[model samples]
Target: MSLPITKSRFCISYSISKFSRFFPNPSSLSSFYSQSPSVDVHDSQPPSDDVQDFVSQFHSMFHMRPVPPINQFQKILGSLAKMKHYSTTISLFKQMELKGIQSNLVILSIIINCLCELGQMRCSFSVLAKILRLGYHPDVIALNTLMRGLCRNSDVKKALTFHDKAVAQGFRFNEVTYGILINGLCKGGETEAAIKLLRIVEGGLCKCNVVMYSPIIDSLFKDNLAKEAYDLVTKMISNKIMPDACIYNIMIHALCKERRIKEAKNVLAVMVKTYVKPTCVTLNILMDWYSLVNEMKSAEHIFNTMTQLKVTPTIISYNIMISGLLKNKRVDEAMNIFQEMPKRNMVPDRVTYNILLDGLCKSGRISNVWDLIDEMHYRNQQPNVITYTCVIHAFCKNYHLDKAFELFKIMMKKGIQPSMHTWNIFIDGMCKGGRLQEAQKIFQYLLIKGYPLNVFCYSTMINGLCKEGLIDEALTLWSKMEDNGCLPDTVTFEIMIRALFEKDEIDKAETFLREMILRGLMT
Candidate 1:
């Protein structure tokens, strides 16, 4: 055998008398057993073949011991991440550091990955500082891991900071890294910043094209910058960055918002004419667009076309159709669609109830509204704040103040504290019932209880008092309300005029009307 093998066999048999000036003999790992407690490193342990196999497999993965193997460290970090057990993972990384294994890029990458997974971007960045301070150069994978993870978790500020660091460290910020950062900026509603990042990256170091332009277009649409969004679409196609369904859908939404239905449809037609098959999101956006423009026929046509295409309508699709039917007063058909949701294995969510309830209430179908309440209870779907408020508003409108108060009380007792809308409904009921004093009492109570008094609430009470011949009280409250930041409107001035007229004080009424005119009212 080789001299190394001869040395290994001799080393296993007896202690060496001196250092050998010979071949590098691999250490006899079997001698490790005698130096310490015996270890059943092999699968010869019959009781636990599985555990023995695991141990053997682990040792076989990497041969070095002092450098606690990279895979085990990485696997531990991964499991912790998957479990979302961040604190424990952090502690383990600290332990690895204490063992002086000199965390490799892989170990550093995994730790940063875990930090980003937890959305602990601040912590991830702190680890980056540690990596740099240790004078250990991080590779592209390590830098990208931190960059991509931080951006994905919405820690865009730190992600960008790390991006600058990567560039400073001579790591190329490739398309994947830049794209992720742009996506994060758009999602965070920093459209200007996203555009700036895109501009900074156009030095031919990177080949950014139309794919980069989509998010900027989408962001413009999201911020209601429709004109800007429209301009970008033309710019994109001219630049040869072909518009996909997403880009087209975003434009369609913006155009529909502006009531430019024809232009929006042309975009959709372009999408359909191309290989870009209309997706559910596209169809839903179109349906919403048509509904918003009150082009009911177009909306219905799209719905029928979607069904003919063999693409099953999602819950959102069904809800939009039901809302359209109800808006057109096709109550029975709307109810049928609502009832048929479960047969397709789709259960109604909060939006479904909200659409139905709003429709019924708007149509003054209070009896149907009550039926929905019962249905909600039967289906174990507890009425939310909006549901309770809508029903109460309906009751208040019909002068059924007693029923409204009962439901409002029950809603409060159920820990669904009355929202501002709920309070506004009750105030309206009090106003209609000529219970101005009671309304004022509740107003003061709501203010004292720290429930914010919206302008609507303040206006309602001011009008109620002015109409009740409580002009002096109304005037004082109006001044105090303004001092408390409640804005007075044209109706508020009109009510003040009426209150002055109630006292047959024509001089003050005309004087105040002139002041309102100076304030850009009564024009």
Candidate 2:
């Protein structure tokens, strides 16, 4: 497919002299847009029935005796692009070009957007060049797409340069242009530059909106310039540009990160007072923060407030409360929340099950765990490695080594790859259950399989040996651990030093103690 060379009313005569610096040879890029390249088009078809049917209709229109209007084709392409079927959009555009359909700025802009989304920046720019070559002036949307493509690729500097050069060449950009640049600057860690740009835009270049202010404010907080971020919020409000829920969330999250809960609450109060209704995200952030800080009462208050405000709590809301209650050892309250979830039409996710399982295991409420696991199965929520490990840990703590081993075997049989922590738990369990020989066998197996055995792994085996009065064997393993490039940590040395002292090996104990001190593991 080729872009029609004929000039239409949509075409404009413009010079490519300024853009020449970015693309050294405008003519060289012509071949790129003249036809889609022979490279493999990695387009994944959208699964929507409606989209598929629309695509079918689009393909059928291509075979029509008198083809559909260009705007009709543009509409189809635009719809596909809007649905994020970027690859499909590009492919369909190529087909239209092959069919000799006349292209316009709107159609080319869609192609540019698709290329940008697909990270084909080079091709996206080539399309721009084709627009200029065809005597069609590229609109701000097209220019913004290119800038955004550059920013998405993390080449914000190039985007900034493009912006300056475009402005110098008498191209008037709008708020969308500045928004793209500001977001790029913020993401690239040029918060200061972004703020300066915001100031410039605020001073009559374009009316600064929340889109431009949000990124700068967020960047300020991330850079630990909280006061500046808050000041920008004030500036935004004073300019009569009300902060959205997103901005409020950013402020509250930042304050929470700094452990300024009171300040965060004050911001939330301000949001409510302004009649800018808090979104689910706004309350979720506050709920999560309260949970994290163990302020269960405050968390409960937020939870209650959500219902009162008619903002339905999401599954995440329930999960956060359950997790917080679990952490604070209020397992019963967590269970109550878990039970209330289904009543609220909130189905518990794997995370909810895992949290409850872990809490029950830690609380030694093993009897309740089996029923929960059964419920998880009934809900089609298969227990993951974490779930099995929690139960195994509980069993090991209760000296039910056989039961722990049984669960471990079940996990492996179900194709669940145990994590290093899981392996450590089982090995420690065996060692504590006087199954040192079995523990040693597993450790050796892990070594032979080239598992990344950590210091804890080695220390666990060493402690088991020392407890079994096998000091010589423990020392030999310690030497092998070092040889394998696993350095002994403070706990490892502490185990050895204490073992040596208990065995009346004074000289060896003193030597390890001194080494520990020299290594800064001890004062």
Candidate 3:
């Protein structure tokens, strides 16, 4: 039976467990000794006496002297692996090696499976080689574990290579093996190949299992190949295999991505009819999709329906609502949702603050946004790049250049580099303020930094000079703008025409107007 952990004891134990390996001295000596006559490499390996004391300690801790049976040891290792006791795994593997237990197929597969599951793929492959070197048959499970790792790392070709080799070695494909292959092929958009593989499995001597079909359907969904996914679902049912929640969720997500809301709802209905329950991931897909399409009301409805169906929304679900409301310009509603978050027992993350700031900034309420920022700081929430950028752009729009610059400096201090958008805002503001010389310095800085001055920047400077009645200067800058590889916008043409006319240069004005008409910039 598992013992209950109190809060204080848990905290103490957690810290104590962090240094768990100080007791397990694997290497006796630590410091490298070059002058100590490079210890003669032994042709024969050292004896196990070095680890005998720790081996006995392991036995004492468990109150067992004899090693457990293969299955029993497997169960214990599985539990340890699940607990992510990496040190324990390393220790056990080492002890097993020392005992000459021989890393056979079963043991190697189990350890490799655990390592692969933990994203330690390198170690898994090392064990694979060790098993092979030991002259033992590397089982299908071991090969499958490696394939799963390769697939996870998006190394599809490598996985396929292993699959071919395994199949050649009389390894019949299992659900996991096919699932990994189908997932990789679907993700890689090798749909034709995936279909071909399916045909091969169908025609080959190996019988098609119910397990392989789910991932193929799920992969079809992943690729937004909804029709294929739907057909596969039908095939699963006709095969007398029960469609699981995973298959249903995948189809629902596919329908959502395709913006087939009605069909998505239909899929959900079928899921319910089949007595398959929707998990949090299923509801999240719906809510997130609805949010993406700006259908906040529908998103909220689905969220409510999810709760009614006993599906608890994770923090991600709430974030979707907040984000959708903000993007739809329902700032007040977004804030209301944020304010009432504590009522639902949810804490505000950086995303929550940034979303609120974004809505406020876009609506031209920088003062309130500043207040919100202060409140966030008061609440011990730090501003991130999104928050800083939003506030800086807001300042630039309100001609609060000083404040915007301050935030830019603060962002740099926080190790958050200002993006091109941030630079554009300041440049636009500077041009508008008749600070062309300062703007020119910034322009050059941007150019040297490899950031091209976008069309807006070019037009803004030209328009600024034109408004100042500096026709010659504006024309010169316009030519320099073109030389810098900045394309002239429609606004740039209009500004040039206006500048020429203001200077009473009638001929030049007519010439500029002709260019504008020739470019089809204005009707």
Candidate 4:
């Protein structure tokens, strides 16, 4: 029997029972966590263990005692919220509904928050509607939660409009309300509007804080307004606010991207003078820029400097170094650094393996690829689509079609769905190997499966038919692809033109040449 009494009562109740031990009564709820829970309740997720314990306690208290007061349910919801157990919080809220506990702003706010976090904004608005129906205007916190939720879902324009109407209705706004709008605007690539909002803060509309300022400064830097960003930082400092490492790193990265390494170094010097310690991100960006500019010597100097400063290189740092080395064709040095990663207690992620695999494949070190594959399994890392694609591409490139097909089957059997790129690889490989019939079968399967047939897929198939002297079939496929709304690209047009020329169909080829010109697709 599910505690909430839904249709699948047995299944629901069994699910509730799993965490029933953590259910809290009014008597036990106050001292549950040593730290008093937050009221803001947005994204304050507790660790998994704490969450599990809270669940167990809630379940116990619910079944053992008479139903607690509504306030007690609110407290439990808040705690579940801090744990980010949103679904569980909603479930418990439904259970509260079943017990005849009337909804109050406190409980409704918690529900609204969970709905927002779950990206069910319509449901959150419905909860807001319920609060209004019960003659309770949502507090600023509740309203802010809704606005932030809209921002998170990338509905910044809607959030802006919502806030504007609320203000028109005489709902007073706070710093948090403004902050949410500013953050939303900056993230949505409307930094100009965000800067204008920050000016409102400067005019004493609201007190400025780091949270409101940081994103605008970062966005300014992103828009290549480095001087303006620095000017804003200066203003912040004038107001006795010190810039954090994140802001400094943004400046460093912007400078590096513009290849103004000297200016980036100047910013680093200022950071050093201010006693702001450089992070791995700071070092990695510098190293990445140096390597990209073919200045490996400078990159190595920074790598060595990190060791001297007692700052441990993160996996990202190592990955950057290895990638830089591989691009410079220093394969041996790349391998050595990869080997050193384990010594630093760093586990290699998929990117790390992919880089090494690419380098090995390019160098024709096929035997070493399997060794890395075995090591990936040992480390509990499953090879993803990119991993399989890399190996398949290598096999196809090396004329190992049988091996490529074998691996393709293995990936599918393991439930790794082949991406369009994967299909293209096999199709192109078959076409190159003069296996036109096999390529045609794969093309037919793609159509039957209703996978999006892109220009490359169509071009590859048409090219295969042309190679086999089947001009009529190729032309039919071309017409079919166009009818299916797959717009032909330059390569597709060129393929058809060449095929028509080969078959002495000069008039049809001229028509296509004119059509290509009309579409502005000719290179």
Model 3's C-alpha root-mean-square deviation from the true structure amounts to 12.8
User: 394-478 in candidate 3: lDDT tens per residue?
Assistant: 8877888888878888889889877777777777877776677777788778878877677877777677667777677778878
lDDT of 4 at 72: 70
Off by over 4 Å in 3: 1-123, 135-139, 204-232, 241-243, 254-259, 289-295, 342-345, 364-383, 433-437, 498-506, 516-523
Query: Which one wins on lDDT?
Result: 2
Give model 2's TM-score versus the native structure.
0.82
Per residue, candidate 1 scores C-alpha lDDT tens digits across 362-430 of: 778888877788888887788899999888888888887888888888888989988888898899788
lDDT of 2 by residue, 441-523 (tens): 99999999999999999999999999999999999999999999999999999999999999999999999999999999997
Candidate 2 achieves a global lDDT of 0.85
Q: Distance from true position, residue 111, model 4, in Å?
A: 5.5
- TM-score of every candidate relative to the true structure: 0.71, 0.82, 0.74, 0.72
Deviation (Å) of 218 in candidate 1: 2.7
Model 3 Cα displacement at 289 (Å)?
Answer: 4.6
lDDT of 4 by residue, 1-523 (tens): 1012122211111132332222234334322222233333333463467766766665665665566666776787798887687867776666556555686899899988987888977667767766777899889999999999988998776676676566656787788987897888888887877776767666676677777888898888888787889899899899887888888888899889899998998888888899999888988999999989988888889998998867889888888888888888888899999998888899999899988888888777777888998899899888988899988888888878888899899899999999999999999998998777888999999999999999999999999899888988988998899899998899998988998898899999999999999999865
Candidate 3 — what's its lDDT?
0.69
Query: What's every prediction's RMSD, in angstroms?
Result: 15.1, 7.0, 12.8, 11.4
User: Quick one: best TM-score, which candidate?
Assistant: 2
